[model samples]
Target: MKKLTYLFIALFSLSLLTTSCREEKTASEKVEEAIEDTGDAIEDAADDVEDEVEDITDDNK
Candidate 1:
C-alpha cells in the first residue's frame, strides 16, 4: 500500500512539473514574436510616410 502511494505521488508531481513548464514561452519564441511585431511597426511607418509623400506631391502639382 505504501509503495502504491509513493508511485501515485511521483506521477502527480511529474505531471504538474510538465504542465507548468509548457505554460511559459521559450526564449526563441519570445524573440520571434518581438521580431514580428517590430516588422509590423516598420511596415506601418513606411505606409504612413508614403501617404505623406503622395499628399505633398499632389499639393505641389
Candidate 2:
C-alpha cells in the first residue's frame, strides 16, 4: 500500500514538473522578438519623418 502511494506521488510530481517546463518562449527568445519589433517600429517612424520632411521641402520649393 505504501509502495503504491509513493509511486502515485512520484508520478504526480513528475507530471507537475513536466507541465511547468512546457511553456513556450524562453526569456532570450522573448527579448529578441521584442527587440526586432521595436526596430521595425523605429524604422517605420523614421520613414514617416523622412516623408514629412520631403513634403515640407517640396512645399517650400
For candidate 1, the TM-score is: 0.63
Candidate 1 lDDT by residue in tens digits, 27-46? 99999999999999999999
Question: By summed lDDT, which 10 consecutive residues of candidate 2 come out lowest?
Answer: 15-24
lDDT of 2 by residue, 1-61 (tens): 9999999999999998887555699999999999999999999999999999999999999
Whole-model lDDT values for every prediction:
0.95, 0.96
Report per-prediction Cα RMSD to one decimal.
5.6, 5.7
- Per-residue lDDT, model 1, residue 11, is 100
- Candidate 2 runs further than 4 Å off: 1-23
- Model 1 worst lDDT window (10 residues): 16-25
Error of 1 at 12 (Å): 17
The positional error of residue 26 in candidate 2, measured at the CA in angstroms, is: 0.6
lDDT of 1: 0.95
